[model samples]
Target: MFQFHVAPSGDDSWPGSAERPFATLDRARAAAREAGGDAVVHLKGGVHTLARPLELTGADSGITFQAYGYGTPEQEEPVISGGRVITGWQERDGVWVAEVGELDSRQLYVDGRRAERAALPGLPGEVRVTATGYVTGGGEPLGWRSPADVEFVFRGVYPWTEARCGVAGVSGDGDETVITMAQPAFGWAGELYNSTWEGQSSSGPGLPTRIENDAAFLAEPGTFVLDRSRPGRHVLMYLPRPGEHPSRTRVVAPVLERLVSVAGARDVSFRGLVFAEATWLRPSAAEGFLHYHGTGYYEGGGVETAVIGEGASVTYPAASVTIPACVTFDATENVAIEGCRFTRLGASGLGVTGGAGLAVRRCAFDTLSGAGVEVSGSRATSIEDNRVHHVGLEFSGAPGISVSGTRDCVVAHNEVAHVPHCGIVVGSGQGARILRNLVADTMEVLADGGGVYLSGPQGDSPDNQALVQGNVIKDTHTPYNFGLYTDYGASWVTVEGNVVLRADNTAVLVVGPPLENVVYRGNFWDQDPLGHDNPPSGVTYGGNVTYKDERELNAATAGIQSEAGPRR
Candidate 1:
């Protein structure tokens, strides 16, 4: 059993002993490779920032990264980051300005609280300028010293669409801040009915309620402005929380795309490491979102439903440093990641593909823009006893933990809540055991979604092959959001022994066609378990229990939250 040590202030030339640790993860992994067979690397408690991804291979097998001198079993381990901490702030003209590098980031953190990008003061006026932004209802004399640093963030433009674009230039046409989009809006929005590339004025008054990331919107504390007009770069922040100035306040931004990644390896593990502050490109044509059009339903008797719209929906353009995964595995086998944290990430936390006995247990995934932990085409994978929340921050379509096109995978004993979309899903393929999990506060902002959604099958597995059992799903307060949904020709699925409480729609929705022999039994719901638009065949639902009082059922799963995380 060989052991390598890594510290924040250590040197790469050091022997990786406890007294003289290695500086980078690469050095420790090299030492582990030299030692071979069941070696462990202990990371000292602090931030270990990565300039590039720590790419691992089959040689990286039988290695582990564990945190040392930090955290109890109940506390978080040391942080390994793809982010650079920003310091050296000066009060310039009432705003705190610090020079960051020439890097692009949509997410920013101030004193541990997520800061909103600068925004417009409020709603805009009736008139808009060509492809530029709207003439605001109150666009007085605004000073946009750096238009390149300014971005127009349009929230809730439609059900699933949110728009953000940098300003090419700002023209004050009389009382209007004519915000010209650097990338034309029509090119981004596409040719909708009459909606031009220049955002067509909605038939109604307007769609956007919050337009953010401009200088005028930086009135409140915890709001920030990034100015890229100067020689290097500058981030202007408005600090609101008490006892926080430049010296006292700490800011961080993503520097690398991925902190840790492994591919084509076997028998490795990542233990007790905090993966944080990784960046992702905001969804673009380069990294486009697929419009599936309910494409999971299969029509052919021979061809099965593909796992489209299943895992990470954004097809990020191919680049090592662009598509960041906090910790990723591909085509590996017999690996484990235990008691780790996946937080403040711009993209998916853990992405495992085509691996067997891959265990991601007792981990926490928080404040992520993409899916929490997504596994695809992996056999006998185990994702158990983890806590996931506040994920899908930028994209609302991805699930918290997406088990797609995998056989005999176990997604059990996890607590997933406060996510924008599905909590746990078996998108395609089969033989999954979804058991003893707690799902709540989900499906927050999408047009149509559920807490636990099952789509059509890949030709390999039948509907009854997966088991949905012993989960507590509740408090999904969005329109068309259910506790459970078997959508788009989901066939022969078994749903049993789950507690479904307080969903916006029916507790279970089995919609569309080709549905056959779906059995539902011993499940508890506060409302009607089935959707109003029920499918046309082969559903045997009996032995189900309904309750008008949801508190009783909530009491049944009472110890779930405390078991998963500290009280928020």
Candidate 2:
């Protein structure tokens, strides 16, 4: 079953059916390498422009690039696109040439004879250079000669008029003047304004332009690397809207940073796409969405995603997903990311650390700028049936699912909501199985927090065996909140038949030390008359049902028993 059709008016043979088709995707990948092995090249939707970056070499059982309808089929389905309109410019000898415009600009020759130039008074054409006083001969008049022993380069003016201007110099001594700008001029019509070194430096009119020196300018567009030290400067003339076309929202962040380094290439796939309104800067910890390093098996099917801004939607621009405090995993196993939709990412949306066995099913991680699913050092993982909602907005340390140092993990039947903190957190794990999950409006505030938060560390022995059973925690705002929180090195834990309701505070909270074996059976605590927080030992409340106000249970003793339900 092989059918190819890629417009621009088809015809490059190899049974080029669909009424004689085959425009380009490298002549349908050279007729799928002369029909020698794995196949399926059907991309017939819209836009396709790739002059470079298309490497899907030989195959040995690794290929599947699909996108042909099923769920999320709006914005004009069947679309595979690529763009390039960086036009003409040349000044080979002496660095300052232009011809890459989707929002282009060029002009560089900041040489004030052995550089050291200063003029700081509301920057009227700006100048601040010093990095061992620049000296690169030949009729020098490019300003900057010692304002603290110099090395400076600041040549500006490319807010796109289809950019084309010239001048170049960098004859050694802390050299730097590499400006290859056109990722739509810092994307979405560049307007990340506000820098005089950020905050309370009044000089407003359209405030958003800064350039400090030690000579180092590198804003590599396509391969992605938005910021690299030595006072790197950028503020390409703001244009939110006014006949907008800053290279089609800055070319959707260099085409999602070149589709995350070819998304683990090997029979690669990027189908029917439209990466709109972009801006993904500095995402590395081996980045996400699709990252598999060799040993064949890199497949990405039917991706129709959108990342507004904040480092192109994931991997901590502000924090939606950031895993890379140093990653190490060799024998990378069959990685898979199905049906994608990771919107408004930031502050831990889906971060799995140092992968071993990762799986994020039926993906739909919510409007985040932080926390909705963060698993650390993954090993034998399975975050099943996901439908995680609008998590903590960068405040109460957001949690809707946070597991640490993973091993044999299983956070089953998920459906968590507007979390502020702790909706299901098993920190520093071992044998974890937080079964049948359905936690609601979990722990917002009241100092430390819980809706099923089990902690570890403080004499070890905690990560042995954990099981917070049959979950269904209800509306909790916080008042020393607890629906099931066990601290102090939890060992062999179990909180059965869960259904804790509208608790203002405390339903079952056992803190630090004394847990050799803990169990609270047949649960149904609908307390809110302010109760709970002190049961460090002997916790085995059977056939549970403490309706409310039994004189606030008068600080239960005598093996605590009150059984009686049906009063709100």
Candidate 3:
């Protein structure tokens, strides 16, 4: 174990004790590299400003920079902050400007103040300008000598013309200042400390409402305006929303896209940080806070976070977190994610494209904007002992768990609730097991749904062949009468030794041409068959206790032993 303390002011040295601490993360990183072994860089309790994203590259071992007072069983405090800062400003014409290279640009001025693009004696009405300009009010033009007392303001940036404008409207306590965008610009909108827009119009009227009062808007690269009709508090545009794609998709959020880009980077772990208020070009299927590309183990310690898109707002009727449907996994193997919470996620909470031997345990997935977990094109994955609740967006075909194109997986011991569709579904997976799980209050709405649905392959050979056993399903409501359903060449699927209670329809409904076999035996059902439509051929039924009503099963002469299995 190596101890290195990082602060704003100190020298870089090895053997860094409490008295002799190291400053800057770069020097500590160098010491860790020099040791050529597992390393631990303990960051002291203070903000360590970073100029760029910290990239760790080396052998997959103990390369950890942890907060000194974080992730203890009794008490934990972890804080790590990164990103660059704007240093100097340039006054081009009348607008005060600062440029952080070609990557980002900013204008320091109030709303509604307009600056001249060309060298002019006074503010001109219209100028043939190559760059967009800003107007600063409330005295003289910033960096100029004039006296104009005004408060209400508006600011606009025309990135296409390389100019920005600021305007002043009214003056008084009632004269609230606002900054509107005449043209959409790149980079984060600064803190709108105490200003508001009464009602402004944009190409997308819903766009401004989607930005939270304190939220940051990374204006879509185009042309738009900020209007200050009725002054209100100004909003900031810093972090991107979850699932928002950049104008140039190539310049997507770097940290969010890192996992999908770096394939086969092993033994990576991210702990005690917030990855909130950022967007990814595509939804990531990696298992931890820091996504992984290759076969690696990821463990998070009590981190509460969210990943949402720019378009998603508090008023919008969609989940903020959006994931891309397609992800490429480069032959990575053996992944595990534990002790984290995923909330307000769009599409699905956890998605997997291709991998081997995956395990997710003891995690809570709540307020899912889409399905809880969607797995495709993977092998030997286990989703065990996780609490999945309040999933399914409005007017969406969502489930607690949906699987497709995988083999030999297990969906076991999970508690699923408040889903509008099936609780657990094996969409097109083969030789999987759906066992010993408690499913309650599933299938909230929609006509055709089930507690557990198994759809086989469209062509020859069933897609799902598994054991649905020893599970307690209750309060399943659907217009259709099938609690456990299978269709589309789904054969050799057995529904046995389970307890079903308060089902609106049939306890077990098997739909087929009887291609292979589906056995329903040794289970307790609240309702019995009115008449036998399909006999025991490919579908067999025996040793089951039925109740005409709740009293019969508990009566003395019911003659139905609940523990009997497969009565001859």
Candidate 4:
């Protein structure tokens, strides 16, 4: 086995070893592949900027990229990033501006903290559509002079879509304004003229969006606006935090979409690295979720004032909407990513498809716009002991770990919290097990969510079931949220031995489909019992350890263990 050392100061021309370190991970990976036979590339502590992704193929098998002499992931360990740090800045018009190279960039980070896009919620008042495609609304018109440059991005009548239309101009009387949307709706969420949901109607719809690249929203420190919307001027305007000068504060914009693309690579492990600020592709479909009725997202005779509609029959962010992954794997096996920090990513952290014996464990994912990990069509894959929180920040319907079309997979010992939608969603396939993960504080944004959700979208298909057991699901306070939810068509699921501590609506929620498909046993719930929305067969609930009071329940389930036995 060969050992390669990579540092920021070393050169690719030199032999990659401890004494002569390589300058970049690309150089080290190339050396390791040539060396072959379980070569190790030890990365020294520093930030490595990646203008492009590090693509690893089958030839790079058995190569391990680990930190130099580090037991656990240190704060200052090797960070492989997809952002370009820009330093030269000159303040102009109360907004610090810096000329940038990348024009289509959307995500920006200042001193390792994400910058906020300038966005205003809700129009000042209800809008009126005129003969010309102009929308006149009586609300706070976003103050903008450059009509050709500043666009009106928004969540239209269908709250499940995030789109923008170029502004013809901003015209109105004071706060009340007539904002003209571009003909086809150009930016992120764009659809047909007057397009509504599947079963909803709308007249004058659309809320003001958090418009990036606008200088109006730069209010305080740690907030930045990348102004690429203007012609010939790709400027990044930022408000630095207190005591953080522009020269000192690192301002970065995500340039690369993927950090590592491990396709057809086997027996390779990426450990103890920080992957941050990776970009995601703009949506091709509708992606946004908002229930106009209330924050609870319940629709009990709730009128549809959001879009020009009577009532809403379809949910926003339909299951078909999907974003790209940051670290993608396909047709590869025996790969692992351990002790990594996946934070401030613009998209999903990791995705594995068509592989086996792959593992993503002991990783921390935070401030992600999409899901923590997306696993599909893989068997014997393990996702364990990871901490995923503050995910699904921008995306509407992303779960913590989305497992679909995979069998004999294990998702255990992870902590998923503060998510927008479900915690762990097992969409299809059998022999899949979701166990021992502590899922809490989920559904903070959208509605009708669950900690552990199971469903098979293919109707009347084979009995698709997953072993749901030993998880402690708690604090799902969103509307229609539950500890465990088996949606319609999610059949043959065997739920067992889970401890659910809920004070909201129900502990176990079942919705739709073949009633005889779900089985529950030996579960513990101190909260209310099952909440079945509409089941033709009803749930089969038995052998459950239930408690009335919180104190008694806590005492009874104190020493309870997962099906895998006590956590080591």
Candidate 5:
């Protein structure tokens, strides 16, 4: 194997040896390509900021990027960051203000914690949706530095959907105000909502639940506002918490949308590193964000009728899109990522799409705006022994880990907690084995989801049927959420040997579309299963146990809980 070294203090012109290391990852990558054969690049400690994403294609295969002297006390995992530090702060009129010089960002992090954007509870007055925008009844519009920079945040047709739209203009003065929303985005969102299942309950994507990014709402401590009214002189205002000094605070704002992009690269691996501080800015554009479910959102025009069953269909926008990831893997083979840390991101942590022979293990993900790990259309993928929490920070619909449209995948032994939506979701996959995972405190903000959810068909033959087994799910809050959910037209799957506790609704939910050839066996829950006493057609329930409280549940499942989280 060809070995190379890279450090933050080294020079780009070096030969990439242990004694003389390269400064940037790009430099080491170039040397590895020239060296030929399998190569390993050792990344030294300290932050490595990327101006653009590290692109790896078919030419750069059989490479592994790892921390120098991994598993040793001397090795400090390097951080690959896509953010810029903000400085030159000054206290003005009881708030701190900084000049950013034409920078645009949707997220801000101070001392490793996500800082809230300036926001108000709702619109200025009693608001009503109109053909073009909204009109308030009788309240004065506050003195906003830039009305166009303001955005309206609305909960979509479903409780899990959180959407945002821009302001075209704010018209009218005293006693009443007319707010014109950005075109196409506002109109298309309404059209998309009306065509879906959730829209049947409401007239449209109604008035804004909250308004954000206006300086007038910058009273709360640890909240910020960005004023882009003046060209080349944009200002960022912040209200610091008690005993906090502006000069001592470390503020980071995302600059790049992605940190790494791997496409058609085989046998590539990354280990013992951290990916941090990337943002997806499409939601901040004029098109805005019209979220549907999970990471899928409505965009463009027109609608596609997706038939879930013989006579049942759901309307989706012309284009259903997902948030980008900080580290992306596409159409690769034999790729492995282990012992990595992902945090303070404005998008998903990792996205593995259309790949084969993939393995992701022992990773930690938190404080993200999107999903922790999102895999789709992959084959033989294994995601195990990871810890995910506090994600879906901005897009509340995103799950902790989701695998969709894959085959022969295994997700096991992971611990997911403190999420806004579901903990783990497997959809439209064949031969999937979701085993031994510990999911807790899920559905903290959204509704209509659960701790472990499965949908669509698993496989055609009995030999390839999916299995949901040996998992422990607990503390699923919010109404309409279950501890275990077999939603949509789930078939050819066996739900066995799992434990459920403290679910707000039912212990197990089997709904949406028609159930076919599904089995619930040997599972344990705090309460009796919902509607399982009289099982539905094509569904079988037998040999399941129910306990009354936590004392009884924990005494029965001690071994499963001990082996659920990361082993390392």
Candidate 6:
């Protein structure tokens, strides 16, 4: 196998040898292509900033990008960053301000922790929706430099979805401020969900739950607001944490959308590196963000659902959208990503679309605004032994690991926690195996999700049947969140040997939306489901044990939790 080296201190003009490494990953990729056959690129430890995404194609097949001096005394973790550090901060009235010329980003990271965008807790006063925008009945909003930069955030009709619409302008002096929303987006989201559900407010898209941005809302510590009212003189104001100073703090904002983009590639592997500090900006545009469920959204479209007895149909919109990932794989084959860390990302960590024979093992994904991993239209994929936590920071509906529209997938022995929504979700897949995973403290912010959620039909034949076995789910405290959920026409699956410690509203192995040919057997839980004594047709329950005592339930599932999660 051929070999090349890349380091932050190296130069692009170098020969990419062990002593003289290339400066960037792109140069090493070029060298690997020239070497042909099979090659390995060693990335040295340090921050390697990218101005644009590192693109790879089918010509770069049989190439492995692994860390230099891995597992050695000289090993230092490499960070591939798409962000720029903000310097030259000055103190002004207890707030630190920096001039980030022409930079526009929705997320800010200070000392490796995510800072909240300065925001008002809720809308000013009683506001009513209008066709043009909104009209406040009473509020004191007399003076402001930039009303257009302020955004109105609204919770979707469902608990899982959240939308943000831009403010075009705000007018009126004394008691009423007529806020004009950005064209098309404010109107599109309002009419699209009208009459769709009875629980929806009469105001169509509903009122803004909170207002964000503008420097006036920077009262809370550890929060930030960007003032882009001036074209080239954009200022960033941040309220620092206790005992934190501006001169000593490290602040970063994302400048690129993606760090790596692989398409039509095969036999590629990435290992033991950190992919960090990237952003996605579509949600901040005039098109706005109108989420439906689980990363699917609507832009100038509508969704229609019709439930057929033993059958269900959804007439989704023409423009079906999902959050893009910072590291994307499309139409690739035999790709492996192991022992990597993805953090401080503005969107999903990794997206695998239209790929086959993919394996992502022993990686860590956290501090993300979107899902940790999203896989769609992939075959023979195994996502095992990963640690995912603190994800869905901005988009609460995104699961830790979401797999959809796939075949022959296995999600096993992973540890997922501290998420706002589901931990591991398998939707619309065939021959799926979910086994021996540890999921805890999920569904902390959203409803109608769970620790383990399986949706849509899996397989039609016996050979391609789906199985969920030996998993441990605990601390799902939100309303309507189940311990192990099978919903939305899930069929031809067997769920067995799972342990559910504590679930508040819905109990373990809960089923909804007319399941078919599903079996639950030998599962242990603290509480029995509401209708476990008599289930609907096409669903069976046998040999499932329930222990009301906490000690008994813990004793039963202690072995499963110890064996679950990453082995190394």
- What C-alpha lDDT values do all the predictions have? 0.67, 0.41, 0.44, 0.68, 0.86, 0.85
Query: In candidate 1, which residue pairs clash?
Result: 118-213, 118-214, 119-212, 119-213, 125-137, 186-197, 517-538
Ten contiguous residues minimizing lDDT sum, candidate 1 = 291-300
- Residue 32 of model 3 has an lDDT of 69
Give the per-residue lDDT of model 5 (tens digit) for 1-568.
9999999899998889988999999998888899773899999988898878999998899989999988787877799999989899988888988999988888999988899999988876577789888888744443666888888888646576788898888767566788888877898777776533423334457878888998888989999998888999999888898877877888888889899999999999999999998888888788898888898888876776565444444556777888888899999999999899999899999999997999998999999999999999999999999999999988999999999999999999999999999999999979999999999999998898899988899888789889999998999988888899988888999999898888975454346576788988988888887787778887888998888877877888887777676676
Question: What digit string (tens of lDDT, one per residue) describes model 4 on residues 347-396?
Answer: 88888888899988788988887788998788789888889888876665
TM-score of each: 0.83, 0.25, 0.49, 0.84, 0.95, 0.95
Query: 3 or 6, which is superior by TM-score?
Result: 6
User: Candidate 2 residues 1-568, lDDT tens each?
Assistant: 3445455557666455656667676776666656652555655555454544344433411433334343345422332322232223332332223333232111111110011112221222322322212233322223422112111111111110011111122332233322222222122112221123222321111211322221122222111112211232321212122332333333221222121112222333333333211112232111111111000011222222223233332111111223221011222333444444443332344455544555556555554434566677567777766666665432234577777767767787677776655677777667777776767777653234577777662122445567777676667674556666665456566677666666565454444444546666666565621213344454555565565644443333112222111011
Tens-digit per-residue lDDT, 1-568, candidate 1: 9988998899999899989999999888888888874798888888888878898999888887888743465433578888878777778667777767676676777766677676764454555445434555445425655665554444344443344444456666665566555543323433211122243334211334445565656677677776656655555456455567777667887767677888888888777888988886543222223222111111112211222232312211121112235678989888888888899888788888786888987889998877899887899998888999998776565578887788888888888998876787777777788887888888776656777888786333463377878777778767767788777666657888887777876555445544565667778777776543463456777787777776775675455423432222
The numbered model that scores best in lDDT is: 5
Model 6 lDDT-worst window of ten: 307-316
Stronger candidate by TM-score (1 vs 4): 4
Tens digits of per-residue lDDT for model 6 on 1-568? 9999999999999999989999999989988998893999999898999988999999999999999976577766999999999999989999999999999888999989999998886666687778878888654443545777887777745666677788888788466888888977787776555443433234346877778888878889999988888999999999998989877888999889899999999999999999999998887788887776777777875555443233433233456689999999999999999989999999999999997999999999999999999999899999999999999998888899999989999999999999988999999979999989999999988787889998889898778979999898999967877888888789988998888878874343334467898888888888886568788887888998999998988888788667777777
Model 5 / residue 9 / CA error / Å = 1.7
Better of 4 and 6 by lDDT: 6
Give the range of the ten consecutive residues with the poorest summed lDDT in model 3. Answer: 155-164
Candidate 4 matches the true fold with a TM-score of: 0.84
Q: What is the lDDT of residue 245 in candidate 5?
A: 85
- Residue 64, model 3: lDDT of 55
Name the lDDT value of residue 135 in candidate 3.
27
